[model samples]
Target: MKKIVAFSLLVYCISCSPGPEKNKDKKAERKKEIQRIAVKKDSLQRDTIEFVSYNDDFDYSQLNGKKGKEEISYINDQNNDRSFLRGDLIAIEYKNDSIYIAGDGETPQNAEWIVSAKKIKDGKVSKFRKEYNLPIKYHYSKEGEISSTYLDHLYKLAEYYIANSKKDLIKISLKNKEQLGYSVEKQKKNEKDYYVLGIYVEFEHRVSPFQWLYIDPETDTIYEYDLPNDKLIEFP
Candidate 1:
C-alpha cells in the first residue's frame, strides 16, 4: 500500500509540470506583445512630430564660380539643420544612415546643412528649395506669334510650382490631364504687363482656377495671386 501511494504521487507531479511545447508557446506570445507595444509607441511619436526644411540664411554666391567639389564653408543654422538657400538645388543621396551631396564627377560628401525637423509638414521641404531658374525670353507677342519655347517655359514653371505646393493633390488628380493643367495669359499688374499662368482643374466639364502665378519674362521673378488680400505676393 505504501509503494502504490508513492507511485501515484510521482505521476501527479509529473503531469502538473508544463511541457517544452507549452513553454515555447508562452515565449512566442510574449514576443508578439512586445512588438505590439513598440509599434504603438512609434505611431504616437510620428503623430506628434514631423521633419521639414528651411533656409540656411547664408550667402552662397561665393561658391558660385567655385566648381567641381570645391570645399566650401558657411555658418550652420543651429535651430534648423535641414537648411538650404535659393538656387542650391544640388543632387542628394542617402546611404549608410547618412545623407550625401554629390557634385559633378566628384565624390559624395556628408551634407551638414541637412538636418532633422519636428512640427513641420513633409512637403515644406521641397517648397523651401527654389528649383527653377527661368530663362530670359521675349514677353512681347503679336496675335498668333507667340514662340513655342516661351510657352514651353511657362508651362514648365507652372508645373514646378504645382509639384512643390500641390504634391498630394496632383498624385490623385494626375490621371486626368484636364484635372491638372495650366494656361498662359497676358495680364497687367501695377501698371506693368506680365505673363501669368493660370493653374486650373476641370471637374465634370467645369473649369475652376486654383492658382494664379505671374512671371516676369525678362527677370524670371514669380508672383502668387493673393485672392483674399487682392494683391500679388512674391512666391518662394
Candidate 2:
C-alpha cells in the first residue's frame, strides 16, 4: 500500500516550490540559467488517501537493500553535455496481475502493444514485460471535474529533483490551458483499470548519468554497473 508523506516535509515543499534545483553538475555561471517550472494549481489538491494492495511478492521491502538506493545511469546521446555517469533513481515502482504479464510469449517493452502473445520455439524468448509508461487512474466527478485522482506522484516529485530536468526547461502553454504532461490512453496489453502515459521527459545535467528519463523504468535509474541496452535484472 502507498504510505503518506511525512507531514512536516510536505508542508515545507508545498509552500516554497521552484525553491532549489538539485544539480551538483552546474557551475556558478549557470545557477540562474535553467528554466523554473511553477507548480500547477490542481497538483496541490488533497483528498481521501487510498492505498493500493501491496502483496508479499510486491512489497516495498523488496526495495530495502543497498541496491534500493544504488545508482542507475544512462547516456543521453542527444544531449551529451549533461549526462549522468552514475544516474540517480527517478522512481521505483511495480504492479501485479498486470496485462504486461498477462500472457506468455515473446514481448519486449516496445512490443507490449501487441494484442496477443505469440508462441515461441524452445530456446527462444517468451513474453517480455517492462514498465508501462506513466500509468494513470484518474477519477472524475459527476459534473466532469477531476475528482480524487491518483496523481503521478513519482513524476510530480521529479519537479523537486535535485537534478536539472529538461521538462522544467521546456515551454508549455499552461497559461493557454494546455496539459504539460503526456497523453494517456487505455492499455493495449490486457485491458485494465489504468491508462498508460506516453510522454517521456529527457533530463540533462553534468551528473554521472547525463541523460535521464522519466518513462521507461529500465532506463529511469541507471546503476553504476548496468550498461545501456543490457538486460536489466529485477530483485526478488
Candidate 3:
C-alpha cells in the first residue's frame, strides 16, 4: 500500500510541473506581440507628413520683373510660403497636405492668408536656406498670422479629405459673412443620403483660416446638411 501511494503522488507532481512551462511560453509570446505592435505604430506615424509638390502655370505678367526672378514663385512661405500674392486666382496647382475651405463667393477666394491648426513637421517641410534672396518677405498684415504658402497645404488637405471622405454632408463657413457655413452635398436619385464637404472661412471673421468635417452615410452617396442655425447659408 505504501509503494502504491508514493507512485500516485509522483504522477501528480509530474503533471503540475508542466504548468509553469506553459506560463513561461505565454509570457514570451506576449512580449513578441507587443514588440511587433510597437514597430507597426511607429512606421504608421511617419507616413502622415511626407513631402509633396504644387505646380501652377500662368502668365505672371503683372507681378513679374519686380523680383527679377522666375516670373513665377516656387518658394512656399507659411507666412507667405507660396510664389503668388494674396489675390491671385489659383487655376491649378499641386502640393502636399493642402486643404480647401468654404468661400463667400463663387469665384475662387482671394485669400492672402491661410488658416492653419496643425503643427509643421520637421522633416517634411522644405528647407529654405538663408542665402537665397528670394521674393519672400516676413511681414504682419491686418488678418495677422497668415501664410502665403499656407493655402498650398489647405488645398492638399481638401483633396485628401475629398478622396478619403465617405460621408455625404459637408458644412462650410465663410468668415467675411456672418450668414453661415456652406455645404458640399451630392444627392443621388435612389439614395436617401448625399455626400457633402463642409469648410470654415475664418477663425472669428478676421482671418481666412478654416477647418471642417464630413459624415459617412448609411448606404447613401449624398445627403442634405443639417446645419446649425448659427452657421447655415445657401450657396449658388
TM-score, per-candidate, Cα-based: 0.39, 0.19, 0.21
Collision count for each candidate, in order: 2, 20, 44
Local distance difference test, candidate 2: 0.26
TM-score of 3: 0.21
TM-score between model 2 and native: 0.19
Off by over 4 Å in 1: 1-144, 166-178
lDDT by candidate, in order shown: 0.49, 0.26, 0.33
Q: Cα RMSD (Å) per model?
A: 20.8, 28.7, 19.8
Top-lDDT candidate index: 1
lDDT at 120, model 1: 31
Overall local distance difference test of candidate 3: 0.33
Error of 3 at 202 (Å): 26
Cα lDDT tens digits, model 1, 1-236, are 99999999999998999989999999899778655543431111111112212323343211111123443332233333334322233432111111223342222323223122232332432442333222212233466356886675565566556655644554455433335556667878888888877666666756556777889877666888888998988765
Lowest lDDT 10-mer window, candidate 1?
A: 41-50
lDDT of 3 by residue, 50-157 (tens): 223333333111121112222333223343234432222333221322222345222221222222212233221122111221222112233433354643333333
